[model samples]
Target: MKSSRQLSKIVNIFLHIIALVFTYFLLQGGSLIIESLPNRHTQTQLEDYLDKAQLDALDKSLDASNLEAETLSFNQQSVKTELKGLKDVLAIQQQNYKEMLASRYVTEDNQSNRQVEQIRQKIEQGRVAITEVTQKSNQLKQQLLQNQQTRNQIQQEIQDLKGEARKVLRQEQRSNTLKAFLIRLLFVLPLMAIAVFLFKRFRDSSYWPFVYGWGYFSLYAFFIELVPYFPSYGGYVRSIVGIVACFLVGRFLIHKLQDYLEKKREMEQRDEESRRSSLQNNERNLENSFEKIHKGICPSCDRKFVSPDNKYCVYCGLCIKRECQTCNTLQVSFNQFCFECGEPHREVQENEHSEEHAAEPNDGINSSPPTPSGV
Candidate 1:
């Protein structure tokens, strides 16, 4: 292919050479045409001048012969004098004709010389123009050759760039594959180990199947890297298989991790509940001890009790009320069932005792009053 291209280029160069040769011939032919054009015009003008000079000379000779005839016919002295004057006129006319002829020759020679000079100048100008054109053509050809060389260099550079790019791309692809493999090993391998450990702990042998499947997937990934020349569709198929395998393995690992965490959380929760229950029991025991130390008597029943001044009596339904001994004022009991006096229920006992003593001395004074019957 390269040789053929070189041959084609050689053929094109030969064709350009042929074209330049043809152009040189064309320019030469044009110079010839320019040179002949002025000569042809000068020749026409010279012929016309010669014909007019001949006709003028012939007319002058005829006029001189007529003057001589008039002289021969005259016999008088005056006529003879007139005939001499006519001969003088004929001589002047001949002299004037000779002067005109000389002037015409000089004028024609001057015009012919000018025309030749013009033709020569035109030829020189044509040569100059041809030289300038040839110079321009040479410059153009040089520029074209330089441009062709530049284009060839650029094409070579492009090809080199493409080759370098392909090399870099291949290197990058390999680097990426290696990096991916390392990353997968760093993450998936540890995860697989953890899965295996958990599987042993849980005694679930079924997890081994997924481990084997992941091993197969790793092998497949390795194989995919090995056969890099495969078509895009083939690579796509391998990628799909690898993805599905990785997904399945990942799902299994996640499920195992979830189960492990769930079990751990359940155990921790049970321990936490047990600790909470123990704390609650300890709090309840402390509360009981505090209650025993701060016991007060229930005043409603007038009984000797551990919880004196208790608002609700365990033995009786009556609310405790105490009366002042000095003013007989009724007050809610809080100070050992009586807020009015330091004496514990002394006023309420005394009032009830007097009434009860009047009724029956044997009954120890009724500290509480009985409900009145509606009569």
Candidate 2:
């Protein structure tokens, strides 16, 4: 019997495990279905919320300014190169004129003087060219500085615009997140409602495994899927949700406990015969009775026995044990046969009932002595 009980327990455990596995697959499938719902919020890009035309125009202006700056930079480089070449040419011309003046061919001939004048003229022309090139370089530097300042201002404006656009994007994203959360909630709420109805009405039905599986899925969907998306006012929302759930569950348990106590009290008020008859007619299965008996409790009233050998329940007066008439051996009263004599106890009980009926006097008001047939 103990081995049988153990086997039953093992089978019950496997049923629960199978139920959990079934719930796992159901949750997986449900998650896939929930995920299939279109999410427009997640597809949103930052650029989607920005003023595209304004940004594009700004970018174009910035690019054009950069191109112009590059051209100016190249021109500056050319100016520097030209100035260097002019300076080199001026130095060579001065050296050549100095050498010609110191040469023995410098006798004051008219041709020599003419050549000296021509050298002076060439030196003056080179100085004027150098001055003009220097002026051009200075102007280029000024223009480059202005261009740099303009680019800096434009970049700052672009950054400011982008910053504002980012703020708007974040706001929109948060709003969209709320909308999406509501949509998912709407989708899941009906499922949770159905699961709750099934749990309340049919959880103990024959298809309890499926009901439990659905209950687990609904709980997971609500707690895991929906709760995280709850708009948190510094966690107040989640706390409130938790408190409400706890209160509901606690209230249900309290009510169930009250109902059980009330029913027990009503049952205890019944007469012994009625109580015994009720027990025989509505008794739990042998397995439950054995468990209660093992725990030293009266199977009829569910009250603890004063001693293991007690013949009847002290509270309910339901028979627990009695001696067999055939073998004078004590055994459980509910058993149909005695262990020692293998005598059927029901026969003895029937004989005893017959004898009690025989001993009772007639009390009916309409009773009369019967006349002899000859009279």
Q: Best lDDT goes to which candidate?
A: 2
RMSD of each: 43.5, 10.1
TM-score of each: 0.27, 0.60
Query: What is candidate 2's lDDT per residue for 57-153, written digit by digit as tens?
Result: 8889899899989999999999999999999999998998887787626565667777877888999999999999999999999999999998998
Candidate 1: residue 296 Cα off by (Å)? 62
What number of backbone clashes does candidate 2 have, counting pairs of residues 3 or more apart or in separate chains? 0
Per-residue error for 195 in candidate 2, Å, reads 3.7
The true-versus-predicted C-alpha distance at residue 326 of model 2, in Å, is 9.1
Give the poorly placed runs of model 2, Cα more than 4 Å off: 1-41, 97-112, 193-202, 232-375
Give the local distance difference test score of model 1: 0.45
Off by over 4 Å in 1: 1-109, 196-375
